[model samples]
Target chain A: MAAVKLLNCFVSPFGNRVRIALAKKGVEYEETAENMVTKGPLLLSSNPVHAKVPVLLVDGKAVCESLVILEFIDEAFAGTGAQLLPADAYARANARFWAAYVDAKMPECAGKIWKVPKGAPAVEEGKKEMVGVFKTLEGELGEKPYFGGEALGYADVALVTFTPWFLTYERLAGFSIAEECPKLTAWAARCVGENECVAKSLPDAEAVYQFVGGMRKHFGLE
Target chain B: MAAVKLLNCFVSPFGNRVRIALAKKGVEYEETAENMVTKGPLLLSSNPVHAKVPVLLVDGKAVCESLVILEFIDEAFAGTGAQLLPADAYARANARFWAAYVDAKMPECAGKIWKVPKGAPAVEEGKKEMVGVFKTLEGELGEKPYFGGEALGYADVALVTFTPWFLTYERLAGFSIAEECPKLTAWAARCVGENECVAKSLPDAEAVYQFVGGMRKHFGLE
Candidate 1:
């Protein structure tokens, strides 16, 4: 068997998706931590366009983008572990829909809170936007145990990866994902707590907050 | 075999993608063209969130999003036509990377031209932004015959889908994709002229320009 290797760092929601997927699939792989700050050569060469981490290097080949990696893993390891998606077409498409939604809309919304600069106009705007997204997510969650309504499918994987970040943002930004979105928040907590892969994969919430807090400075926020 | 049905509108580049894929694959299917100006139950039910067209209803199950539809079709058909993606993992990732880039980045560039108001401020700003993106694309294209190089691949499909709109913009907006981006414009022409599927999939260029001219009234550009 060609040895599997993952180029990632600690607590990357994007990377965590792959990490948890690997663990769930029972695929043993070596994890190489790449510093996201400087974004060393290997990371650059692997993903020239995005230059981001959580790159899955199978043998020597690298795959970029979290969602793409998720799909690749599911297809490549079809028989390995719990299927990441449904065998039915509509179910799979629905999962992909939510996954795309999480990647495109929700993450950007949640990202605003993390990027809020003290006293900046964007801060207030970001807060407003975050709440709006949270409400939408809450409405979507409604009373479902998971996004797919029973199984921890791709939608759950996408949403779960962000929960750690959301927890950190709720505290560091002095806002509340749970206060405004109790069901969604509760669901997130439940998902994380129930899954050993998730619980063990995430770092302490404060560490994530501080890590992102430094990122704000690097991006020249405020 | 599950019956294939497509819900689309004439002008959406997204819809065109599915059309081209179907034509290339020699897969015959029933198509329902929706008038996007007026809402339809089929469109509404198929894609409630975006309520957009290019929804591929495979055996009555809706698969929204052009790229996702393409993937579904590729997987569903399996053995027919030119493969939309490469078989090798890294190569497939690169193709998907470019596809995502076109969907994400190219649109803002194309939108600058397509959505440009007739007035000077909007036109100038649009031209500047459009040219900026063109420059990036041109540099990326370098000396390649297509975005994915010699053989037409996913990136080519992406660029070709939107070329009709660019052609219209060049004529109506008093700008030229060719002048700003010789390589990209040449590539676009090559794609449309070279591939019978691409050519057949697009409405006449002048017809699209006339259509754009009509849209001015709706957008208040008139």
Candidate 2:
């Protein structure tokens, strides 16, 4: 019943997070795709601090940062649907820790994959680090089927969006994420296959691959 | 009552956040200084992911990451003392955004002060960006006496610890933060002056200056 609107760029993993969170909560709202390069007024007004995508506007109130918005959705719509985070305090803290790790580690590794030219030696190093990043997550995943442990919870929501980027990174760096991190690869597949929210919210991996190629060209990296 | 132990380096702002948060909650805990460089076995085992400092051990369960620790402390000891975050969901989300800003923006800006040689032109650019960072916070602070409105809240706890580093940055960069952002200066002073926990938790500024100088020399950055 609350008016919920999201300002986002669809191809963004960060934007995918908000979509996944809202969908999990069964919150219906409007979403606008903001041009990230050209300054958009709505995004500027909503998130004056970062001016970044995935700004959730609830009845005109704005929540920025995908992780914060996930927490917001969980808290604001307390009774809505499945909670992204765990109910136990310690478990919630653990989930937050891994989610923070995903944010801290992912972008740098993901960027290196595309930032380097296809045949460059740097691409090899980038692939090594990218695989390392996934290996870390795979180690964390352990015997648990999901990062949330039997549920598609906070960290699952946090990380699954970026699986779409795996195609882009793998192709650019000439490495196979599925081969490097089989368990994590399987887990990602399970998230997309099992969770309608995750499946629907995430952009197609092929689309992400095309976008990354275009972006590298646009930024003169290509 | 849970058994709480903190593994941290004294000068780290991240460590200070945990100390302040614990003190705010009236929680009694053991403090062990961890060598961030050598990284003791306790820290390694406690935080295998990052192997970084400021890991909170509650009943021997390791909670890594300062911000996550802060949230854990708030939730784990619900009835102990003042809540770090606001009760309202919107306000809580806002607090998280600014805290994340402090984490994302501060280290990079603060690093430029010490990471560069004192006389380098990079210091001037760093100084400008450092001032810009403060101004953004000043703008966010607006007419409020505290970021939490009435008292030392989450964002306040998140940022106040970094004030000790300001002295070193200003000394190295030759720019006065007080002049650049008077309101934030006043607010920082108020936090240190008013909050006994903050006053005791933060390392002395002069000590930080010496540490930075020594570190620069050790790293061959001078």
Candidate 3:
């Protein structure tokens, strides 16, 4: 077997996505925690273009980007635990569709709920935008137990990865995602409660909220 | 064999990307030209999240997003004429890195070069911003004959997809990419001249320039 290793930071939701995948797949691997604050030379050499983390090194080959890393992990460990994706072509495309949707749209919405200054115009606009996004997810869920149906597939993993951020943002923005998106809210709660892999990988809700709060203070927005 | 269908528009660079990919792979598919001004129900229902076109439907299943569809085509038809990506994990990640970089950065740069009002402050700022992005691409390219080196890959495809727009922008903006980033300019020339798929897929230089002129007039900026 090729030696598997993961380089990550604790706070990045993208990093957390890969960590959960590793744990969910029951794949044993070495890990190196990178200090994103002052990224080192080795890190720069490994990923020259972006130089960001959540880099998965498999047998000395480095793969950057969380979505790409997730695909690599699924392909590398084909028959481990639960199948991260469906085997069917169209089903796999739909799973990827949601994953891309989350990566492209939801993350930006989460950013709005996080970094925007309190009472800033962006904050209000972001709030409206995020609400709209959450409502769409609610419609997609539409009483289904999960985004990709009963079993938690790739889409669930993508959404669940960032759902924790909602709690943090809710405290800061003085609003709740649950109140706006009930089906999505219930689905998120179920994910946190049931997925041990995801549960272990996430930081405490209060800790995350405090972290965002500290960031706001540092930027003189609080 | 599954039926392959592409829903696209004539001047949309994104839609052109999928068309290029399909042609490069030597896969036959039916084409449906969509009107972006007033999107129809087929385009809307096919991609409800972002009712955009350039959707590739394989066996009646819609795969939206040009890059995502490109990956699907590569994966589904692995042994076709040209592999859109590298098979190795690291190489594939690198390919994806540049593709993402182009997707994130190019539109803004192109917008500045095309959409910015002729004499506005924003136009001047857009020009500066475009020069900066080009310099970055030039530095990355260095002395490599191609972005992917040896053969054209996803990174090359990403840039090549926008080749028509670059020329159009040059004419409309009254500036030349060749002067700003000589290497990238030369790289593009090599791409369009040598690559059969790209050469056949793109419209002539004058046609693209006219397209940009039409877009500018449509937006009341020209």
Among these predictions, the greatest TM-score belongs to 2
CAPRI-style quality class for the chain A–B interface of candidate 3: medium
Name the candidate that leads on DockQ: 2
DockQ values, each candidate:
0.44, 0.92, 0.53
lDDT by residue (tens digit), candidate 1, B53-121: 888887787898888887777777768888777776566776777787777766675566667666546
Residue B6 of model 2 has an lDDT of 95
Chain B superposition TM-score per model: 0.91, 0.97, 0.93
DockQ of 1: 0.44
Put the candidates in DockQ order, highest first.
Answer: 2, 3, 1
Most accurate candidate by lDDT: 2
Query: When only chain A is evaluated, what TM-score does every model earn?
Result: 0.91, 0.96, 0.92
Q: Which ten residues in a row have the lowest lDDT in candidate 3 chain B?
A: B118-127
Provide the lowest-lDDT 10-residue window in model 1 chain B. Answer: B116-125
CAPRI-style class, candidate 1: acceptable
Model 1: reference contacts kept, as a fraction: 0.29
Q: How far off is model 3, as Cα RMSD? A: 2.5
Q: lDDT at B56 for candidate 1?
A: 88
